[model samples]
Structures are given as C-alpha cells and as structure tokens.
Target: MRLYKIMIVDDEAEVRQAIARKIDWRAVGFEIVADAENGRDALEKAETLELDVVLTDIKMPFMDGLELGAELARRKPNLKLIVFSGFDEFEYAKEAIKLNVVEYVLKPVNAAELTAILDRVRGTLDAEIEQRRNIRQLTQAYQESLPLLREKFLLDLLRGPMDPQVLEAQAERFGLAVREGAYKVAAVCDIVHGGEGRPALSDELVPVSVRQMLSDALWDRCGSEIVLGVPSILVATAWERDPVESLMRLLGEVCTECKRILGVTLAVGIGRPCQSLAELCRSCAEARTALEYRAVVGLGKPIYIQDMERLDRTAPEWDGHREQQLLSVIKFGTREQIAAMVDKLLSDGEGEWSDQSRVLGILGTLLSILRRCRLGEEAMLGPRGSWIKLLAEDAPMEALRDWLLSVCLNMSGCMDQRRVSTAKRLVEEAERYIREHYPDSGLSVDRLCEHLHISQSYFSTIFKQETGRSYVQYLTDVRMEHAVELLRATDDKTYMVAEKVGYDEPNYFSYVFKKRFGVSP
Candidate 1:
C-alpha cells in the first residue's frame, strides 16, 4: 500500500506535537507532511503542500479552522478534512459537517480512530488508480491490434492475382492455414427492399450481437474449416472430391437456415476451386457475378457457376462485325435500350446458355464485340484475362456471361473517352482479372506483373495512370462496391460477404469495409 500525505493544524504546539508523535503514520499507510501552530499558518502551508487529508483544531487565532477548511474546500475540492478540538460544541460539529469535513474526532485524537479513517481513504484512492490503469491498457491493446487486423483482412481476400511471398507472409502473420493445395470461394448476399439502393448492414446498424448470432449459425452449419471474407465467405475445403457440390450444399443450407431462423433472405454464388492463394481474385469475381444475377433472378437462392452446365464449356471466337454492333449499341444506346439489351443478352439461350459449349460461344461473341469496340488490349475478354485465364479451360457458361457483363459495366466509364482507348481496354482486362481470380487469397502487383509479362515498375505506373488509383486502392474500391450490393440485395452472413470479395479473414475484411463505407460489412 502507498502512503497518503497528511497535514496537522492546531493552535497549541503541545497538542499538535503530541498527536504527531503518538501515531505510527507509516503502519496505517499515511505520512504527516506539515505541522502548523495556527489555522492561518496551516492554510498558508496547505496552499504549498500536496496534502491528501487535513487534521485541524476548530478554534484558532487569526483564522478559525472552519475558515481555513472553507477556503481549502473551494480550492481543492478533492481533499479530505478531519476536525479535532477540546470543545464538543454541537454548533462547531454542525459547522464542520456543513464544510464537508470527513470526520470529527473528539478533543484528544485516538490512534486507532485516525488509523481507520486513513485506511478508508487509501482504499478509495487505490481503486480509482487501478481503474484508470485498466482503461489505459484496454485502449492501448485495441489500437495496437488495428493494423494487424487490417492485414489479416486483405490476406483473406486471397482469391486475386498476388505475389506468393506476400501471401505466405500474411498467412503466417494472421495464423491462417493457407491450404495452397485446394480451396473453394463463395459469395453471400442479403436481400433487402428489392435491392433498390445501398443498405446499411454494419454492426452499428444491425447490432454486433445479432451479427454474431448469424455468423455462428452459418459456421455451425458450414463447418469450422471456413474463413469469412466479408460480404463474402470463403470455405476452403479439400478438392480431392467434388468440392463445388459440397460448397453448393453448404451455401444452400446457410441460405435456408438464415431465412428460416432469422427471417432474412440470402443468396450465394460459389466459384470454381483453385489450387493456390494466387487465384482468389477470380473466385471473388465469380462470387460477384453470382450476386449480380440476383438483380435478374431475384433472391432466396444460390447460383453455382459449376451448376450452370451449358455456360461451363463456352469459349470466345473472334467476330468483327457482330462485336462492332454490340459495342455501338452499348456505347450509344439509351439507358432503357441498354437495360433491354442487357436483359435480352442475359436471357438469351437461357436453356442453351446452360450448356458449357453454347455459353462459351456467347462469351466468344461478347468478347469479340468488346474487342472490336477497341475497348483496349488489356480489357479482360471472358476467359482471356489473367485471373480468369487460369480457369478458362473449364469455367462455366454462367461464369463467362457474368464475367462479360461485369467487365462491360466496370469499363462503362471508359466508353466516355475514345482517345484513351488503351486505358479503357486495360481497365476492362483488369476487371476480368479481378473477377476471375479474387479468391486466390494471394493476388498482388508482383504476381499480376508476372501474369501480364510486364515489369513491376511498368505495371504499377500504367495501372495507376489508367485507373487514377493504386492497384490495391482500385481493388479495395471494387470489392467494397460489390459488398454494398450484396448487403442491400441479400441476407448472407457478413463473413460470407467477405469471402465473396476475395477475403478469407472476415474480421479484417469488415475493418476495411468499415473504413471504405463508414460502416462494417
């Protein structure tokens, strides 16, 4: 226990000395800092002394102890005071009470009584100090963990094109088991008000307790080998078997359970499996493509690219005239016309579109048109981009169609400028890469350069100059934008959303999503 500073005041020198000498101040955790023969002197000394408790005689010359106590009360409201004197005058005691004195000890102060008072004060002070320390520790811990949390989140979005070393480092830092051997990505969405506008689904908006309940429910049903990627959920299960089927089943169960128990609708999109973290971005794109289908297909369902048999085998073949016509229509068409065209193209060969061969055929047609529009050489044309290129051999038709539409919309702004046609093309290509490989959990600039056959410095410079943002910034923006769509249109778990956006770590994804949208995913 720490000792508290005490001050003694009395008109009689003998009385003051007797009290100070009689008490073993250290035994009870107190030390007398000053002694005064009069109230006036005591008041003056008190001003200069750092005292915790004051013991004073009421009746004194010049200024009474009452007056000194009143002045001390006004100056140091926190200081404790005790009154001691020969007179047992009721009036004086009453006055002491009015002055907020701690206690009134009779004429002769007893050591036992004084010790008790000091002990009580010590207890109070210790408690207050301890509380302050705990608060400081808690604040410091939260601040220190912020950066680590952010890195963990980006690593979870491992489905994009990224450097191997960077991904390995992130996995090690975050305690993530990057099963470079096999993994599957899934996109989760929550249906809200018919998907009319962006919705606020943050912890503040929906309550963290409720979000936890939803997350636990999904995890309980999906198994523990899953990582929530924010606004998307990535379930990394073994691919030795039919992983897509298993993923689809888990997604279906989650959607059904969420709707049945929480009274909220959900939709899920499962991407093709990848062998390593480098292909996460493509997985993210697949998830987003699944989410976009909600606008046309409605909610309370799951869209598995693997299940769309027809679109699974389609491939793009060059067609100059048809490609030109599609570009002209997209560039010059009215919003209504564009919407109608979009609907037609999305619905076309709805039956045949399910066929992988026919789906590839349509993708080929769309890409040719996109290419002829001179959208740029870097623009992703279906299975031609980096991330998606990895999956071109076996990707589904629905994935291809979804990828085409997504690329078109993502580069829609580029169409506004024909002079920088190359920039627009690169944006398109980047979009394709992002969609197809967002789930690799290891996509980054170094890896992107390797895929594009360009130098790191050159790639960085061109990507920034064309997109007006750093590669990471652009990727985050796109992920967050898609996250907003999922939050508004479906009732998928927050972790599921994280995975959909190429994030394997849900917590980190939520942190970044909060920073970008001013709210958590």
Candidate 2:
C-alpha cells in the first residue's frame, strides 16, 4: 500500500521534533514528509507538498493553528487536519469544527490518539484509491468500444442534414479534426470484379487494404476523416483552398496504385467542394450520382462530379405511390432521408413552373403532418398562412425544394432537441468534475466518464468538442496552472511543486511545465 504523507507544525523546533519522533509513522501507514516551525512555514510547505495529514499546535508565531487549518482546508479540501492546543477553550474547539479539522487534542500530544487519527485517514484514502481503480477499469472498457461508435458517427455524417452545432459537437467527441474550409467527400468503390474478373482476394481484406492506403495517402493532407462505407470506403477531406484539381490527382493515383500493387481496380467518386460540413450531404449525394455514371464514364476510374455533364431529365411523374412514400418519410425519417427524398422529388424540374401544383401538394402534405404533430403552421413556415404567399412568390423549383426541406428539418429539430440538451448538460457536468478533481493524479477519461455515467469514448469526444482540447490535455493544463500559482507564491523546489500539483514524477512535471509555459517549474 502507498504511504500517506503527514506534516507536523509548531512554533518551537523541540515541539515539532517531539511530535515527529512520538510515533512510528511508517509502521502505521504514514510518512513524516515535512515539519515546520510555525504556521506560516507549515502553510508554505503544505502548498508545495502533497500532504494527507497535518499535526499542528493551535498557537504559533506568524499564524495560528486554526488559521493554518482554514487555509489548508480551502486549498486542499481532502487534507486531514489535527489541531493541538494547551487551552481547553470552547472558542478554539468551535473554530476547529468550522475549519473542518479532523482531530482536536491538548498540546504535548498523545501518541495513541495520533495513531488512531492516522488509521482513519488511511482507511479513507484507501477507499478512494480503490474507487479510482474501478473508474480506470470502467474507462478502459469504454475506450475499447470506440471503434464501433466512430463508424456509426461517420455513417451519420455521410447521411446527414445534421445540425451544424450537433455535428461539430459530435465530431469533437469523436476526436475528428474539423475546421471552416472547403469540405468534399469521396467514395471509394471496389471494382476488382467489375474491372476485369474477380481477383483472388477476400472481400473484407480488399476494403481493409483500401482504407489503409487512403490513410497513408491522406496523413499529410490538410485534414481528413475516413470510414468503411456501406458499399464503398468514405473519406471526407478539408482543404484550405479549392482542391478540385489536387483531389482528382490524388484519387487518380490511389486508383492506379491499388490496381498496380493489389491487382484490384478501384473506382473513386469525388464530390464538389462545399464551404462547411453541413453541405457534405449534398456533396455526398453528388458523388454517389457521379458513381452511377461509371457505366458510361467507364469502370476503374476516378470520377469527379464537377466534370460531369448531367442530362436535363424531367422530374419523374409523381404517382399516388411516390406521394405516400414521401409523406411517410417526412413524418418519421431522419433529416438526411427526408432531404434525399425531396431532392429526388424536385430533380430535373428546375424551370418547370407548371409543376407548382405538385410542389404545393408536397407542401400541403407537410403542413398537415406538422398539424398532426400538434405544431402550428407558423412554427414551421414562419407565419400563420405565409406558405400560401411563399408558393405565390413563384420561386424556382430548386429554391422551393430547399424551402420544403427546411420545413421538414424544423420539425425534426423539435423532436431532436432533447438529445442536444442532454449532450450539453453532460459536457457541463464533465467540465465541473474536472475542475474540482484535478488534484487527484488518477483523474482521467475513464474516471470522469464513470462519474458522468457515460461511456469513455463519448465523454472523450464531447469534452474535446466542447473544450477544444482532449481530457489529458485539459487536466494537465489545470495542474500546470496550479503549479504556476504555487511557484509564484512560495520558494518551493520543483519536485515539491510537482507533488503539490498532482504529478507523481517531478521530471515528467518539469517536461510538461516547460512544454506549456516555455520554462521549467
């Protein structure tokens, strides 16, 4: 078992030495880490060293025992305090209770009483240490489940009309690097069979190999997130500038390299760049559309949607069957699913103003669904009967489709706000936990998540997303801040300062200190 460190303080060196020698501290699971001649000296040492218990006299030179105990209690709420005074005054005892001193005794301390106090502190610390171990185990298990969570998140991002706020929050929780830039999504389709004949390769291994190749190529790129897609490997790339030419070149090389090295031909569909992740679904849809043209564009090629000349086909004739399907999806499907159905419903009808009746029918059905859900027309369309004026405005078919999508998404947002609120609350609770428990050296992702009753992967992702820093980084920053404060206030050695701030290893603390502040502790 790890020993609990104890500090002794009194005005006289003789009294301090006598208390230090009175008990066999090590035999009783305590170590005399330091001794101070006065309350002032003890407070300075206590600020520097990580102490579990303090044995002190009530009356001392610069500061009294109750004052020292109050300061220690404020600085380290977990520290156990023992105050000894010759006076049996009621005021002193009342003050000890206010300061939360653990033990009170007459001066010329008794060895047996001190030993009992040390034992109680040890038991308390041991229980806490065991709880921390359990937290570590829970956190480790949660971490092991992250791969599946990541895959799910990536799938959602692809099939998205995800709220941009939620998207960024979830992305951060998953440790994905997202920024404001040109975002384009690429889909990698395996053509080993479609290219020539099926290669003598395992179907699973093919995607695994392709994903690895994509990672290797993308490692130095601006920023990228890749996941094994349903039928293709999906990659989302963010570049600081328009990367149309650069993306084509890189994916074209990936296709060639796959065929040359693995004897597998790959067809890559590149989407047009958009300004934000919110527009990735549109880009993703376009990429899938480009892949469909591989029959005419040729197999085993990298297809860019921007380079395609789409045929000016008219919107499909809406039948009773299609209208019901759209209504059903609008009522219950995800925002992505609803937008996709709407996009298909509006396609090729760009200049067909005569299709206004069909558009109105779709909007009417949506308004009815909102009404069924107990939502007012104004809640979705911004005014009680403004949808009529909107239709009368003679908007383009594409613009009308976008407006319809917004109506469907507005309802979905109402249904989904509960989840967003939950995520925000979880983040708030986590930040509070970290700030309060930074002194515990074992404070970690597992411990924090366990406290929040959440999975490690989720807490890790959302914490990073909300704070823009990983848990480990954030904890280190908290520790470093306290370390700096102690260094500035007292002449404590580097190792003592390290102990005070939760680092077990002084050298490691110095390394982190220098990295964060450009100077050693």
lDDT of 1 by residue, 1-521 (tens): 55878888987889888888887889878899998866656775775566778988888765678888887875455567888766666466656556548677776678788778767777765654343334344345434433656445554554455677876776567654344334544344443322333322322232221233334434423322343345444443334443554455445545543443334566655555555555655655555544544542346656654332122333222234445445545555555555455445555455334444544554566556555444554554433466357345777655655655565554455554442454456556776787677666578755665565433333444467777886777777778888888989999999988898778878667767876778766
Maximum-TM-score candidate = 2
Worst 10 residues of 2 by lDDT: 309-318
> Residue 162 of model 1: what lDDT?
64
Model 1 scores what on Cα lDDT? 0.57
Error of 2 at 329 (Å): 23
Candidate number achieving the greatest lDDT relative to the actual structure: 2
The sequence of per-residue lDDT tens digits that candidate 2 reaches over residues 1-521 is 56888888887888778778888978889888899877756876775576778888887765788788887765555577877788665365656557547667775578898778777777876764444334344355435533887789877887657888888888878877545455555454545544556643456456665665666566666587777776777778888876655566566556655664456887677776778777776666556655644543456556765444222122112134555566456545777898887776655467333477778777766665555445567777887557677788887777788788888788767644533555678888887888888877677665776576544434555576778977777888889889989999999999899888887768667766886889776
Where does model 2 exceed 4 Å of error? 1-146, 180-185, 188-200, 310-521
The lowest-lDDT stretch of 10 consecutive residues in candidate 1 is: 202-211
Question: Distance (Å) between predicted and true CA of 98, model 1?
Answer: 72
